[model samples]
Target chain A: EPEVTQTPSHQVTQMGQEVILRCVPISNHLYFYWYRQILGQKVEFLVSFYNNEISEKSEIFDDQFSVERPDGSNFTLKIRSTKLEDSAMYFCASSLRAGEGDTQYFGPGTRLTVL
Target chain B: GQQVMQIPQYQHVQEGEDFTTYCNSSTTLSNIQWYKQRPGGHPVFLIQLVKSGEVKKQKRLTFQFGEAKKNSSLHITATQTTDVGTYFCAAHAGKSTFGDGTTLTVKP
Candidate 1:
């Protein structure tokens, strides 16, 4: 089965450095999303994208975060400057349909570590 | 107070024993999805329940949607070591929100 894949499975960056997390969703999928999980915490939604634009975002997705579908298959999340609290497992997910019942497939996740 | 809450955050069952997790949401849901994430792994979709009081079974696992469409449960019969993981119940509307998850540990 086709699955969402993310690059740089593990990323380490300085506290004030910018970082980009990349994802290649299933070729035919239309909607994409970014979620993060602090160690020992529930996964929190960051943002959702469709038609190369953001559909919704949570408070955690503040000024520092931005998402783009720079190419047909590549969806990237950029954080302008990392903080200690930014260290978490960032996951990329996608679904064929942009509806409530559609199943969203998640990537293995990129573990971001801020130093 | 819209949220999905799961009970008994952790469960430990001996091999061949049964296990079940409950999920309740404050608001009605268009659908409910169950996912399993093994330790140090990503969430894998298990199944989705859309209709009120709907029940679906996958192998030894069974999922049920509540009559009010605000609750759900996942039951595993004769658990195996492979069943050890954190099971999350994600409620769906225009946006999807997941419960804190129930961690299951199966002992051999």
Candidate 2:
């Protein structure tokens, strides 16, 4: 089965530094999403994208966060300035459809660590 | 609130024992999906329930969605070590909102 793939499985950056997390979603999937899971916490939705545009975002997705589909296959999330609280596992997901019942497949996740 | 709450944050069961996790939401949902994440692994989709009072079974696992569409449950029969993981229930509308999840440990 095709799976979402993310680069830099683990990222370590200094506070206030910019960082980009990259992911390549399954070949034919259309709906893409970014989610973060704090250690021992629930998965929180950051943003959802369709047709290379953001569909919705959560409060956690503030000024520092931005997502883009720079190419046909690459989806990226950038944080302008990292903070200690921003350290978490970032997962990229995609589904064939954005309907309520469509299943979203998640990537292995990129663990971001800020010091 | 749009929160999806799960109960008994943790569960421990001996091999061959049964385990179940409950998920509830404050508002009615369009659909519910269950995913399992093993230690250091990503969330893997298990099943999706859409209709009210719908029940679906996958081998030894049974999933049910409430009539009101605000609650759901996952039941595993005769648990095995392979069943050790955190089970999360996510609500589906225009986006995915996941529950805190119930972590299950199966001891042989």
Candidate 3:
């Protein structure tokens, strides 16, 4: 089965530094998503992308956060400046169709640790 | 954004016992999906329930979506130590909103 792949399984960054989390979603999937799971917390949606643009974003996805499909297979999330609270497991997901109904396949996740 | 709440934040069971988790939403949901994340692992899609009152089973696991489309549940029969993980119910309206998952631990 083709699964989403992420780079740098674990990332350690300093506070106020920039970091980019990269993901390679399934080739045929159209909708892409980013979610965060703070330690011992529920998975929270950050943003959704389709047609090479952002469809929706959450409050947590403030100005500091940005996502881009710079290339056909690469989906990247960039944090302008990391905060201590930014530390968490970030997962990238994709589905063949609309995310509302289609099943989403999640990546192994990139654990971001900001100190 | 839509929100869903899950019951029994944590569950611990013996190897042969059963386990269940409930997910409830305040408003009608378009669809619901279940995922399991093992310790230190990421969420893996388990199943998706779209129709009202729909029931689907995968081997020993049973999943149900309420008739009103406002709630869902996942039941495991004869749990084993390998069943240890957190189960999450995601209510997707325009986007997916995951409930606080129920962490399960099965002791052999």
- In candidate 2 the C-alpha lDDT for residue A1 amounts to 82
Q: Who wins the DockQ comparison?
A: 3
Alpha-carbon interface RMSD for all candidates, in angstroms? 1.3, 1.1, 0.8
Q: In model 3, what lDDT does residue A57 have?
A: 88
Across B1-108, the per-residue lDDT of candidate 3 in tens digits comes to: 467999999999999999999999989988899999999999999999999999999999999999999999999999999899999999766667999999999989
Provide a comma-separated list of chain B TM-scores, one per candidate: 0.97, 0.97, 0.97
Deviation from native of the Cα of residue A84 in model 1, angstroms: 0.4
The reply for model 1, stretches above 4 Å from the true place, is none
Supply candidate 3's per-residue lDDT for A50: 96
Clashes by residue pair, model 2: none
| Model 2 residue B73 CA deviation in Å | 0.3
For model 1, residues B6-62, the per-residue Cα lDDT tens digits are 987999999999999999999998899999999999999999999999999999999
The DockQ score of candidate 1 comes to: 0.73
Q: Could you give the CAPRI-style class of model 2?
A: high
DockQ of each: 0.73, 0.82, 0.85
Steric clash pairs (candidate 3):
none
CA-only RMSD, every prediction = 0.9, 0.8, 0.8
Residue B55 shift from truth in candidate 1, angstroms: 0.6
Instruction: Give one digit per residue, the lDDT tens place, for model 2 in A28-92.
Output: 99999999999999899999999979998989999999999999999999999999999999999
Per-residue CA lDDT of model 2 for B1-108, tens digit only, reads: 488999879999999999999999999988999999998999999999999999999999999999999999999999999999999999878767899999999999
